[model samples]
Target: MRKHRRIIAAFLLTAVAVGAVNTPAAASPAIDRGALLAQHPLTTYESGAEVGSALTAAGFHTPSSRYGVSLHQLVYRTVDAHGRPTAASGLLVLPRTGDRHLRTVSFGHGTSVYRGDAPSVAPDDMFLSGPAITFASTGFAAVAPDYLGLGAGAGPHPWMDVPTETSASLDLLRAARTFVARQGRTLDREVYAAGFSQGASAALGLARALQGGADPWFRPAAVAPISGAYAMRRVEIPAVFTPEVTPKLGAAYMAYLLSSYDRLHDIYRDPRDVFAAGYTGMGELFDASHPGPEVIAGVPDSVGELLTPRGRELLLHPNARFAAALREADSVCEWQPAVPVRLYVSPGDEQAVTGNATACRSSFAARGARVPAVDVGVDRSFSGMVHEGAELLAVPRIAEWFSALAGSH
Candidate 1:
């Protein structure tokens, strides 16, 4: 265990050194979209065995690995939630292969409250880096965007904001393409989009953007989002008040969502207007710098204790800007996509209910699109809870599905 800890420390040190040495100079007058600001070498797996061992250590299922993997932390330029220019960071994992042209997988990550837990910032975090590493080790270039305000990005994260998630993710793909080009390698135009939980919604949004020609070079080939809260207003919000969601978990999610939405949509004039007197300063805990556990501990167990009655009513029956924001965020599946999509879910998931995936599929069908919701089943043995266990099982399936699609095409 001591040796393992030393190896991780070495990787972190190497990343810091590389980033310090390769940091880009000051930006010019014009902002370059998708510009690679800095690249840091994180770690490398020399063989499939090493990749499997790493996955096992990270508490994720071991997928069939093909090539070794090289992971890097990439700081790139992207627009913030408000459409202002900003810098964001993410993980770029490349497979060690002889092929000059590589297929790409863009993974949207689950919700992260603390900046330190981001994939680029904490590559050893299984939940953050597992999907990206899995895809890369299986021979695809994996790009996992940390989204705005998380990782090395500036400002508080606009959590659950689909537009920023889509923008950040698309920009990372652009940055990855640019980085790979310099190494005599090129990315395939077809991109396989996948994400877990909050990232699952992001993956759907990104696929929509890619289909809508968000980028000139890359296009989404297939989308597979696992355990995502796709229907926020209808399914997700209502579930928060039910027995399905524990009070503590629901309170934390509501706190993060309300605080983030307030930043983008001006949902509340004052913290007191939304939060209960005892929890008036709850929003401040979600400033991205606070540790997630600390933030959770600071808030009350139940949403009722966390919010004012008006605030609770507003969430239950939202109106005005808050309602509009929910509509926008919930509209991820409103548009029809030209590419195939599969929504993965676990029926036992307490946080993001399985209803979300079903609701998303219904929305897609309403738009004359056929999308399937696949159940990854529940893992009783895994201690990360049903939500995370769902992701653990779903990633390998997503990789296999993506590989098959690539093979067919």
Candidate 2:
């Protein structure tokens, strides 16, 4: 982390609504709701070498063959979870060299506790920028949305809110196209999506939304999401109590998820209802300003200790309303993906609880949508094998997978 700098991203809620504005249901027009508020040049990497250096600093390696590229931070208009008009900021990495028939790859970034990890804010952050460079430097137009609450957006981030996550991503795709066109460049109109960790779930949701005709013009070509917690109620939620998993990480995730969920649904009237008195200040952690480790340190040794007895019971055997929210967030792979889709996983991954990939594959298969759950072999320590290792090793492989799909499109 480069001294966490708050870059005062210019956020403006413009007049344009993201989807079709006041259009008839039958007349599904493609609408670009993400209005560009401001654009700032972040940096221009002269070649793959420069991109690699940045990636290394962010704890990763870049793709072997790279192209000179320019990165820009964009503040644009999009709606929030409530469908109210809001603003978001993200990054657009444009390759200086490549085919004139440029296509766009919408990358959903992985988990980051601090708001500073946002692609637009920390352009060199590996989680976002490394993948951005990997895709863009390989001759594709890469766009990484900071999501609704992260980056320059206001309020607490919805860590895994499926609908808003999908909408924000879709809006960014629209924004990217609008921005690219202004530069006298035309895109192939095909959008491919990939993500890791939390982003994997977002990518899956985005794929479902796009396939269901969220955007009439940008059809999905292929989607690959790596090491994601797709099954929350069945696997992810319960795993917090298991000793093998990192209790601190689980506690941090629960704090983020539950606090954000409370805002969307009135599940709890007070923090004490869902969290123990020991976890009084957990709400402050989700302001999107704190770092992951610091947030984790604030949590109890186990998530169970942080939750009230009633809260634990409710979460473990969630009531109708609570369960519904969990189901909605976990329903990433429920819909079929018309395009080629793959769920990359590490069988050895300790971060993600068991059954996430299995459940996703099963859901897709039950719908007669045969999607592969590819296992990316683990070659790192179990600590590394948790999440970051899976991301570091799997991103380039996913990029290669996307490249192979190019000819089919």
Candidate 3:
């Protein structure tokens, strides 16, 4: 197991080394969104057994891998939060099979404060890359977007902004389709969408876009999102002030959210307007350079301690543009999905409470979409956090569901 892990790590490091020296290509005037700008070979698993071993060593449940997988880091054109064209990066994993036509799955990744933690850049970080690799080794071409500003993309990540998340995901699909075509593989129109944490919301957003005909070619076949803060205004924001969530976790999330919103919506004229005296520099912590641990360390213990009195009031009873932004971000589940959808959650999740998923199901039901929020159960292991554990338990089941759906189609 150690040897298999070493092989994976070495190859990933080598890919980064190779990618570092390559100069980015000049932007084309007529280049469309999702246009492939650059591609770097990352790593390859020789067989299904090797793929399974690598994943097992990384702490994921042993999955059935039918084929070897090859991974590539793709720098593609995508729009940033401001609607201007920018270069964003993602991972494109392909199954080593004789088939020329491939079913596709797009996996939106969980939250990461640092850019280096992105899947395309850190394939060995199972939390980010595992699902994409799992889908690829199981015969689906997996596209994992690093999202705007989180990979090699050029801006501060827009945190929970769902529009950019959907756009980054949609454009990555377009880029992946083009990349696969160059290798003589044609992607099917049906895209199986899945994600975890912040990404779960992204997956739902992507599904809504695809179902609503945001893209001319691709349509969502099925969606399975795990432990997302889908109903931010109704469930997530309220939970942060309660004892249900840990103070550190809640503060960190609040800091990230406000800073990101401030960038996109001008939520505050300055950080001091929102943050408390000591924590006023909170916005600088989420600039896509600092590590998550650093951000957590920089903040006060609780959301109440971190925010000013006015700031706390704004979050509790948001008004004006802040209210509108939260409303927009929280609306991912408001539409009725035409495809089969499942919301995976753990009742013990300390960060994003399971109530978020419950709220999402209620919203979906109101829209006549009877989506099920499946409990993947809590991770009881000594070393596991419930939030991370839920994802570990959920990915394999989601992969199995996607495979069955792909086969049926």
The CA lDDT of each predicted structure is 0.83, 0.75, 0.83
Candidate 3 residue-wise lDDT at 137: 89
Where is model 2 poorest over a 10-residue stretch in terms of lDDT? 11-20
Query: TM-score of predicted model 2?
Result: 0.89
lDDT of 3 at 346: 88
Query: Once superposed on the true structure, which residue ranges of model 1 sit more than 4 Å away at CA?
Result: 1-30, 380-384
Q: Which stretches in model 2 have alpha-carbon errors above 4 Å?
A: 1-32, 56-62, 379-385
Provide the global lDDT of candidate 2 against the true structure: 0.75
Estimate, for each residue in 1-409, the C-alpha lDDT of model 1 and write its tens digit. 0001111323233233223323234433455679887788887889878888878776677678888899898888777665556778889999999889999999988888877768887787766787898999888999999888777776688899999999999989989999999899999999999999899989989999989988888998999999888889899888988888777889889988898888888888888888988787766788877776677778888887888888888898886999999998889889998988998988878889888888899999999999988988887445557887887889988999999899999
The TM-score obtained by model 3 is: 0.92
- Residue 341, candidate 1: C-alpha displacement in angstroms: 0.7
RMSD in order of candidates: 4.1, 4.4, 4.2
lDDT of 1 at 153: 72
- In model 2, how large is the Cα lDDT of residue 6? 39
Return the lDDT, model 3, position 349.
87
Q: Rank the candidates by TM-score, best first.
A: 1, 3, 2
